[model samples]
Target chain A: MTDTVMTEKSELPVHMRRAEFDPVPELAELRDGPAIARIHTVVGSQAWLVTRYADVREVLGDQQRFSHARFLERRPPGMADLSDEEIAQARAGNLLAQDPPDHTRLRRFLIPEFTVRRMKRLEPRIREVVDENLDAMEKEGPPADLVANFALPVPSLVICELLGVPYVDRAEFQARSNRMLDLSVPPKERTRIARESRAYMAKLVAKAQAEPGEDILGMLVREHGDDLTTDELIGIASLLLIAGHETTANMLGLGTLALLKHPDQLALVRDHPEAVEPAVEELLRWLSIVHSGIPRVTTTEVEIAGQKIGPGELVVLALPAANRDPALLPDPERLDVTRGEMGHMAFGHGIHHCLGAPLARMEMRIAFPALLQRFPTLRAAGTEPGFRSFNVIYGLTSLEVAW
Target chain B: MVSDEQLLRVRADRDVCIGAGMCVLTAGAVFDQDDDGVVAVLDETPEDIDAVRRAVANCPSGALSISTGTPAGA
Candidate 1:
């Protein structure tokens, strides 16, 4: 066993070194003993890693004690890497970073557009989008990166359609959106991307306002009218466009990777298209793509699982860890498509749960089955690629599949 | 002939559902948008089990839930 060093809190690494999604080794180690332990972040912040199932659920479910707004207020140390203007932009666009009334208000504006009812109408269109990408994949032939060909565009097209974003400018939008997710990059670059994306979204929304369409951005303008300022509209649009595509894209590629790795489960899905509903849930649970829950701050001094959390401390809820905890899931590690686990925190819990979940699920259910059906002999081409380093969103760099 | 199996009603708390449009995309027969874009349950007791399951799975907010209560065959 490697020797455990009790070092100063300042010396801890802020970011995880191992690929964020590959937590098997960590799970094995934690399962062997204590579920919770102290881990140092590269930012020199001390965070308690809650690995047990019960603790994570308890922490996430209790909103009063654990506040999201307070956590966003306290910048994780080493954020000095960012410039003042960039920091200001982050603060301005901190809708998801807020709690309660503010969060409720912002979330209210977004919730209506993302409903299951609304998405159902778009099903055929989403299928068309999937088919379009698959058609490209087929044309491009084997050794093509699924990430580039299939995974990325499925959601990108969907979001573009939803928000009335011009498909012509998607390349620029994707580049800027990706830069926004890069935490390791200097703050200036991050801020620039954030600003550029917001500006582009604002332009899209403005265009929608001038000439409204049946899309979500048009609807938002029509509904809220004067209530939404230009910046807020841009902010909300940017959030939806980015959230709409990036996370779901990661899931599509990663979920496909997971299924490819487990041929037995893949065979089950292939054999039983009827099982797609439960299979998606099981895949979400097994992968837990979004590695950590949205960070919440301690509103008042509170104790969680016997640990004393001081007031105003930032707590990062580990969703993947929670979903995999043995206490909640019987085997925890195994991937059973039919496993009737209550539900997983892949989309998160409580009021702050993912707004784009329905669309993401729809994309997965449609894409996975269609792909399997279209290419019965689909298999990975060459050695599996590695995952991206530091970005909160977890996905393989590329998945080359061939029949 | 309606089987003895209880019919499942899927309802969405309008307060929770963000118009991700996913539910409709996944199972259109069960859910649809009103004139105002809020999700409304069209067929609380969907005849198809697969459609019902899709509606339940597609709900992003977890607002849509399935309930089993027998209604007198009308």
Candidate 2:
């Protein structure tokens, strides 16, 4: 199932760099030097980059001061303008795009579906899903691309089953979602792909509207159909699909590679059952996959790290940099799963935290242990693992591994 | 008189809670969420202060706060 490693080598934004363990020097300079930095973004003007852990925490905690949905109102220079209706449509049921009470109303409908206890109920099914992929990879024998065979498909199928997305259309939606996030691709093209994604989701949503199934989509339709618009439904379903697809897949691929690079850590995660949770936490902190949650707009005059910014200035918090800041832990550079450090903004912070966090955590906790237990001889296949450094989320396009 | 540090308690603002559920994942004894995903402070002064601290630290909404010597939810 493995496609070749992606070799696309476009320049990464200043917040990101090509590295395995730590956020590289580009962001390290920002985190250490000052409370705030003015960084040039690919799609936007110069924005304040809050990389210090404390400062990022402060900005993320107070939505009154740093509002992300407000920032999108004034689009970046190169982007096409969205009309009032278009903007509303775009923000509808989009958790990141809408602030409360709209965001709260939308998120509340889906929260019961993703609670920790609810996710615990999905454990057996998740184990079965991980095992099914592992079984397929085993049947195919050594030198398999873990990204395609295991990392990508496990989460893809889980979300598909849960979101009522057809498994057969995984290829189409995966491609669209991947390209939608690929920064190397033209913005216009990405927008086109995004529309196609919404359209595809709209069909599934329509079917759910007519006859709801037991999937999360069905639950939404049955419970909150009257409360939500069809567009909002489509937006919500499609957002989950894209978010679930690669965030963990990349973490799985890149995490496996990171552990493989550090055999001692890999052994601990594989051998000790108690080690799994901390290992996953460290991997998330170390990888810190998603670049920044979103660009936040200061709603009023603010003081972030003593830099008084006027109202309406754009603010971006670097999760990768914040995770690796010395203030987060004593030595943030090392991938020490045993560090017992828990607060990594890999999932972002404040009202806009990652909704799929529990689900992501469960999949990794199950997949990593089972993969190692099944194939203790697992080693990186000679092929160099490829990383999607240019994407919004940092991860490997392919991780060729063999048992 | 007991020192303020002798007591540990946690408080959750349901209005501010975004239902991320990190609290339960981190310190289930101290927190849960209602049906709509507002945080439910289970044992506000549970013995697991460390776990509650982690939950407070990891919470995205900053809905949960820990203080010493004050009863949570008072």
Candidate 3:
């Protein structure tokens, strides 16, 4: 056991690395055999990184063997001082932090609202949201940070409307959301910001409890108030608020930059409206905005790609490698918008697959084409867009673009 | 009349559906969403069986399924 620990320790680099916009070069080497690597995280923890596509699916698909709730066994290392009450409050209703029965229960309630049929009803409203952002960007003229002016606001407003959070509260929540997902932010600060965000949602939840609106929060209050507690409401609202925007916003920013880099592909998406849907898929697969997914812990000793992972061990899914795996797609690294039937794990896989995927996809399908059509000569400004490397969710902080 | 095994019947598991909507995107004729966005089966024997199969495969939540036991005359 001592020798095994030493070997694992030696395998890790001094500072564990994160993937960039593209799949890391070393990942290709790691994918072929012994697909697991010992890696460090921003939180200063070591995890077994599952690099190969098949292995990632195997690990993520089997929640019983690789438990999402195992990480909740203790407060984060620095957060050990947090009281049990505080910890319980933190975990309250965040679905990603849960396993089976609990996760399934909460998810079942929200599923109806997220169904493709439901999102289709939302498309017209989502389209309006996209167009309004585009109009503002057009008026703002060239040299605007796409991330700020366009990418962020579209989803931000859509989610705000969905949750019945007053649109005026966007800046406050956006700030808290940013800090909450930022790994570079000190853990204490992240925790504090998280608390603030939840408190803000709690206020909205209280209001919804008193008088339910035609929004998701309102619907939950009207329908499932008996089943759900206030903490759970806040947790659900907070997760949706943060997740609904941060991911799709990044995809918009990074996706635009990626398209600009590949004009041939961009032309197809711009000129052919039908191409938008598939382009979104290719972009989602290529960019994979979410970095290593929510880490899972092994409930039992398991072997993946001939490498053995012991019980209670943490496993990280390298999504970019999996999406670009030759086993999943031919010429896996190339950005082919026309590529049909690309079954990538960008939204993840299994029971925890992104609930807002349809909404995110619809937003993109509307936003990208509208942006291109509005600015016929849209191109990147001289300023290089800043990539958020240290953040838990990968995306561009600001992308300067001009027409 | 098609054999029972050959009959294609599609159903949406409303409880488990997270509404990724890949089904409607793949086979719109066979699926539609209700007012709240829960999937409502539009047609059990869709005009395009291949597209229906593709939709079933792509549904992220496994909310969609096909059964062959139900006969047209039953």
Candidate 4:
């Protein structure tokens, strides 16, 4: 197969470029062809975009050819003066930033903590968290911004309990994570937030080291302290904290909006509690809260979809497009909760697939039903609740609803 | 939900399971989970064969499988 490199320096839109609920039309058009297409990065660089469902599995599965570390090494365009120490500090501990051996090792320690059985213990607590927030939403009455009162707090409180972060510190951590992920923020400001967030996590790491509670961070400190570093602990905690809340919170907000827009579907979820699990699955696939996947770099000459992508070229997978690929299922665009499981990439795939998937799934299954059941007459309060397209995680910033 | 007419048998590879809960979610009557989230086959012959088959296919870890009691080369 011949290489389809985009050597031209013309202005191409970023792969993640999208509207409120869908990928831009151009991405679907790209799926028409084979192998690859050109897409711009957030930092004004070009990379090969893989849109098909099968090809995505190939790339994410073959970590030997596609290196996560090389992808992390690509700095934003403006960061010309970052010291090597600062660079290492920033990348340390985040599982998405590491490749095999390191990625394998870190994930092994985390697997047990996220197993379905382990999450079951937290299910009752998750129910309590969902009910507590619903209580507040009830006290606040109709016309509440679901994003603030219901969507955000459920995951925030759950993750805080899991990682041993103080619930009181959520406002601070959420602010830092939001700024850290927002592309519109100046790169320098984002970097500053990254540093501050790490510093804050470092203090928590220190405390965990001293007291060693039963939380995830403390478990690492007690069991794997010799095996892991302070920086690694901080990195793992920071990644889990940001990821644990942001992805689910957005799914809750966006999924609620999607269901409200289609009240027939919402009724299925509200009336039949058994329907809630599959509804959550369909929502994760349809909404696809994570718009663009974490980019991967080709470590060696690799052929994907019949295109010979050379070593070191960046490969961006359009996850929203791939999940909606017609080959995966019939009538890919339709949202049917009865459609058991679509095997979507919403929680991603391969060795680096979201470690917290079971936890995320449980949280959504519990939260969505409880929220819908509590406010049976819930409807959109305003015409325009905004979307978080600019942030790394796609979600509604605020969703106003009235009961 | 298991019946005498059905010949399907379900088995789980616990070590290979990542506990995505896809199996339990897909075939709730036939499959449940342990405290560690590894799948436990409560019933081998589920009344809903299609849901059980889909659960096997959708296991990201490929931990679940099915077998039928038939001669190999019949």
Tens digit of lDDT per residue, candidate 1, span A1-403? 2213233543322223344345646544653455555555434566666655667766766678888777666654555655675554454434677676667677767666666656677899999999988888888888678888888989999888888888889899888877777656666666566667766766787798898888877877888767766666777777778888788898888888788888888887878877888888888887777767566777788776567777877666666677776776588777888773335778876667777787888888899888887777888897676587556676777888888
Model 1, residue A294: distance off in Å is 2.3
lDDT of 4 by residue, B1-74 (tens): 43445466777887666666777767888888775556789986567888988888777766788876532321
Better of 2 and 4 by TM-score: 2
Which candidate should be chosen as best, given DockQ against the real structure? 2
Task: Put down candidate 2 lDDT per residue, A31-139, tens digits, no spaces.
Answer: 6766577666656466787888888888888878788779756643444743567556666778888777777888888888899888898999999999999999999
Candidate ranking under lDDT, highest first, comes to: 2, 4, 3, 1
Instruction: Write model 3 residue lDDT over A1-403, tens digit each, in one string.
Output: 1111122322322112344467557666676545667776556577787877778877777888988888875678666566788778778788988997899888877877887667778989988888888888888878688999999999999988987889897888898888888776777777778677777888999999999999999999999999999989988998899999899999999999888989989889899988988899999998877767788999999887777778988888888778878898788888888874536788987778888888898899999988888887899997777977767678888888988
Candidate 2 segments whose C-alpha is farther than 4 A from its true place: A1-11, A76-84, B1-8, B67-74
DockQ class, candidate 3:
acceptable
Ranking the candidates on TM-score from highest down gives 2, 3, 4, 1
> What is each predicted model's overall lDDT from 0 to 1?
0.71, 0.83, 0.80, 0.81
Model 4: residues >4 Å from true position, as ranges? Answer: A1-14, A340-342, B1-56, B61-74
* Best of the candidates, TM-score: 2
Judge candidate 3 at residue A118 and give its lDDT.
72
Per-residue lDDT of model 4, residues A170-189, tens digit only: 88998887787887888778
Each model's total of backbone clashes: 24, 1, 3, 2
TM-score of 2: 0.93
Model 2 DockQ class: medium
